[model samples]
Target: MSDKDVAEDRAANADMRSAFDTSAAGPRPPSEITGHYSSDNPDMVQFVDADGNRLETTEANAPYAQIVEDMTSQDAREIYRDLVLVRRIDAEGHALQRQGELGLWPSLLGQEAAQVGAGRALKPQDYAFPGYREHGVAWCKGVPPENLLGMYRGVNHGGWNSNENNFHLYTIVIGNQMLHATGYAMGVQTDGDVATGDPERDTAVMAFTGDGGTAQGDYNEALVFASVAAAPVVFFVQNNQWAISEPNEKQFTIPPYQRSRGFGIPGVLVDGNDPLATYAVSVAALDRARSGQGPTLIEAYTYRMGAHTTSDDPTKYRSDAEVEIWREKDPIKRMRGFMEERGHAEPDFFDEIDAEADEIAARIRHACQTMPDPPQEAMFDHIYAEPHPVTERERAEFVEYQESFVQEGAH
Candidate 1:
């Protein structure tokens, strides 16, 4: 055969096979599915609108309102402070990733309220299992912002000890935390920690996952286990519309919260952008769990304002208009409005909070830049809690290898 004919045949075959080759194609964002962000879903529990107006408490929102009514001005201010500080920390982390100070960053920009609300709702005795983007939750649980950046910076697996704060280490494997959370709740049950009349003695577990994680078998299995075991657990699903580039529509037609009904667990959908509503819903769910009412599923309908991570380019899949729509519903802006309208704090208070947020962001940046790389032995040292022969031998060999090189090169 002629070289020209062979070249043409090869090109044709490549074109034909490319259509079926999933690896060759980049991610495709779902076509704009309108309604979740607006008033289209009648079931969504919302206390504040995009313009910061306080809505009348409806039958659907009564539970959330009852919880909010019990909150003090001081509590509201604290929630707002957490939201602002979390945003600042998220921004600093993103900047560090962009500047090559960190290996990667998964920004929790628009979902701050969803995390902070649930995080603040939990008592110190309650345990939390979180996915990678739960930085806001980590912050509320007493984890320093620098501690969150360590994994991304390649300095350590996770800087904080999970047991100390009752918050598990961030799980990179999607939906795995759901299973872990369920198992932990089961353990709590086996330990006779539930059904205690004393609120202080009763403990509940909150498992956090993103919309993308709902597709995992582990998540469904966790739901099944929680349902059958009647474990005191709350599945907090932050449905940010898009799972990375793929929209929630691609995952399922119905919202994730509604799926809980199939598992015989109650489901509640809340306005994730409004901290007040999120806090209210979270309190209700956690309270239910603590009261030994079994598990509850909470779907926080929020949006992802930034790219999935520093490595992703969201502009390729989603439109600018879609992002702009969600920007108006920003949790921080809405919280500030709620606080101002209620006269929760003066303008000076806000200024002081802003200063504090700035300091935190600055500290995060400095810490990321100055973080020391993990020593060569860290890999072996932390592998086995007690001494293991395998790890010990490997460590010795590594040390010997390095010493041999140094001795031979000595002048």
Candidate 2:
């Protein structure tokens, strides 16, 4: 096309975008800015309450409760074990970064239940696309915790084979993974993987993002495409009260789950700190997709108990009072309390879990400290199918520069 033609097309796009602009509305005031954490939304699903009682399910949540009831005590115990270990992994990740063992770490300190519940719900054939803070999901999918350190430690892209576990490499760009998941789900649909009436053959995809991610165009576009194509996927949004430092008010007026309905799909809100609730809801959503019901949006109503990353300071935006309130609702603590009240575990079992967590944490620390660095040239290996002159030149220059440092030290 001629330059004039390209210029005209660009102008046309600019005009179309300008028509939908809403910048004149201005931002909401601080007082009017509300968070998902403040109110108790009665419609939210819960199989266990914050105070450790077996919660009475509401009409909206009764179906999920039935699913939870079908779960054996062993199942609950397994979830509890995951909740504890996941928390330990998160703590270790943070400590590793602080001790300069890793380059950076994104702590999933408060969302263990949200991740483990959804991660445990996946079938072997199902695929998962995760945002950066999905360490718990990685654990549930059988990814070694040390594998995750490679990424944060600046040693490699990702540590494990995604295909081995049906978990994709963590997407650092916000909301981009949703599109990847949607496209994969569409492929599954085209390949006759959904609604196949064979549990083993039927497949679903899961896309995970935080509440702030819902505001991205890629996220909305992925939902639109998935809904229209009847793609078998589930969008799991962990609403951890803040998007980095910005609160929910900066992202959207309604919760993400409620917004899913506008895209012609079902949505559900669950007590993200409640493992049984999250697991039941995720099972239902995955089932719906495998049965050709299209995508489901689940907003795991939870909190960010730590800084967004090791680089952030939560004190700049959120208050201690707020963090303390959510700390009381910690997934591991709540699950332990509920299990104790229900007599699902003995004191010895708790002791064993604590011991196990410590052992696992020790192994993770050792792995992070001793991981071998990738060869210097390894960075440029996958940039193109064949080597380019520019890449080869850079590689030579890097090697000479490193050797010069060694020679100077020898002198």
Candidate 3:
């Protein structure tokens, strides 16, 4: 063939080859071409070192930390007290579940810092949306321990009224609360409860979820809604490293906090094991939201030191070595160390806290054991805002059935 003809023929052959190259074997591996977002980033914001030392930051980056430090000694003592009491209450709930007193109990053994820090950061008017695991957060929001235990004990759907405490009910469905929180925040915006430049009247919503929940469509949709609406909401994701047996690696190829970029919101990853760090990051995000800056995604890098719930056995899917590693970063221990190092607390104070914890534990155990089961009529009371005839009939039937069970000899 002539030179020009041969060049044209070669080009045609190349196009033909490209068109037919659909085989599994290719120039590049599929894995290499596929892009992924990370769910964990070690280099993200970390203000508290593992040694309990606080890292210095610019004046602008210091609001949350300054607030935490400015917490009165009484407030610090109250936080410690609340942490200990809630842990005991959590343990009791777990024990009750095992003893068949509860349907399930989600233990928050290692996440005290993330819960307490974020919980205490809220203003009184700020609303909170919590996953079922937010016993500590509920406690911080002034939810009585007995109220939380009552739910697990199957005595009530949820013990306390959400409106009463500015806290929503424990959402069992994963990631659902993110949408609720976003919707609530949108309402706040429309009502002009936020963006008024009045810190007191301005309101923000904080929604809590876990690493596993981050994989849910609701979580991502919530972010999209919040971002587009510029709603005053904080998406607080507690990355406790496991959604039951599945590790975080299975959920995301990259850190979750980075996912915020896709939705046009800032994402922050804090050391979840450090109470101070969690508080600082959460407070900042909430403040920003309250200031009408829109939503923020906070991935608190914590570890789930216990099973996903009382029924789950992490030993089947996770290693003892992994558990041991996270144990060293226990939130309570880190907080204690930080307090001691800074003279925020003393040995005597710790002793007092321990004694109080024991007392609280005893109280919770007694309360859980003695909590009365709801009357048969109670099941029908909150079924609807307005009374329903069908439900009333069913309620009557249930009450009759329960009454029929009473023996003639019974009082």
Best by lDDT: 2
Best by TM-score: 1
**lDDT tens readout by residue for model 2, 1-411:** 799987975774464344333455864333234333333556588877776778775876888877888988798799999999999999999999999998889999989999999999999999999999999899999989998988899888677889999999999899999999999999998899999899999999999999889999999999999999989999999999789988775687666886787799898988899888899999999999999999999999888899999999999987776777787888888888888998899999999999999999999999889989898868867687887998889989988888999999999
120-157, model 3: which lDDT tens digit per residue? Answer: 88998999999999998898898888888888788987
lDDT of each: 0.86, 0.87, 0.80
What lDDT does candidate 2 reach at residue 407? 100
Location of the lowest summed lDDT over 10 successive residues in candidate 1: 28-37
Q: Can you give the TM-score per candidate against the true fold? A: 0.90, 0.88, 0.85
Report the error of model 1 at residue 37, Å. Answer: 5.4
- Supply every candidate's count of residue pairs whose N, Cα or C atoms clash at under 3 angstroms: 0, 0, 7
Task: Supply the TM-score for candidate 1.
Answer: 0.90
**Candidates sorted by TM-score, best first:** 1, 2, 3
lDDT of 1 by residue, 68-141 (tens): 88889899889988998999999999988888888999999999999999999999999999999999999888
Error of 2 at 332 (Å): 1.0
Locate the minimum summed-lDDT window of 10 residues in model 3: 30-39
